[model samples]
Target: MPLWSLWWAWMAGALLLAILEVVAPAQIFLGFAAGAAGTGLLLLFGLPGLAGSLPATILVFAVLSLIAWLITRRIAGVREGQVKLFNHDVNDN
Candidate 1:
């Protein structure tokens, strides 16, 4: 397949995976979605080289996702002292 077509396919897959992530909210597929979107953008811009770009794209996506997650956690007040799993407080007072 041509480069453009391949990029489109990746974008489509990414969109689908993102939608699934939304439904599931497991925070797994978003990284892949970001990677695919980045790759699609790069392909659309007609970059100088295509070889080894997939790995680079994936790395970029992973880094970006990690940063985003950290920022979100901070904004959401997720501190190390708080229990994140199965810890719901009930108002009994």
Candidate 2:
């Protein structure tokens, strides 16, 4: 059995990432944490062929992370004035 196939490992990683998110509060690690937890659940609940390979598991994690991140971003829309675009360089003076 590969290490990556262990549901506990994924859940532990998810917990750590969730803690990091709490410490930073940037909403970045949260998505990853979600993805990890999802993977862990799938593993624990028995997903067909999920425990058979490493690449497939990783691919699932990546896709889950991306989807979670996108959903989080949409729900948490950027705050006003969060970005500052400077059209002129100060060195131009």
Index of the highest-lDDT prediction: 2
TM-score against truth, every candidate: 0.57, 0.82
Q: Please report the candidate that would top TM-score against the real structure.
A: 2
lDDT of 2: 0.93
Model 1 Cα lDDT, one tens digit per residue, 10-86: 67877997898799875656656666676666656755565246666555556656665555456664467887565
Clashing pairs in 1: none
Off by over 4 Å in 2: 79-93
lDDT, candidate 2, 3-73, per-residue tens: 89999999999999999999999988999999999999999998998989899999999999889998999
Quote the positional error of residue 34 for candidate 2 in Å: 0.3
Model 1 TM-score?
0.57
lDDT against the true structure, per candidate, is: 0.64, 0.93
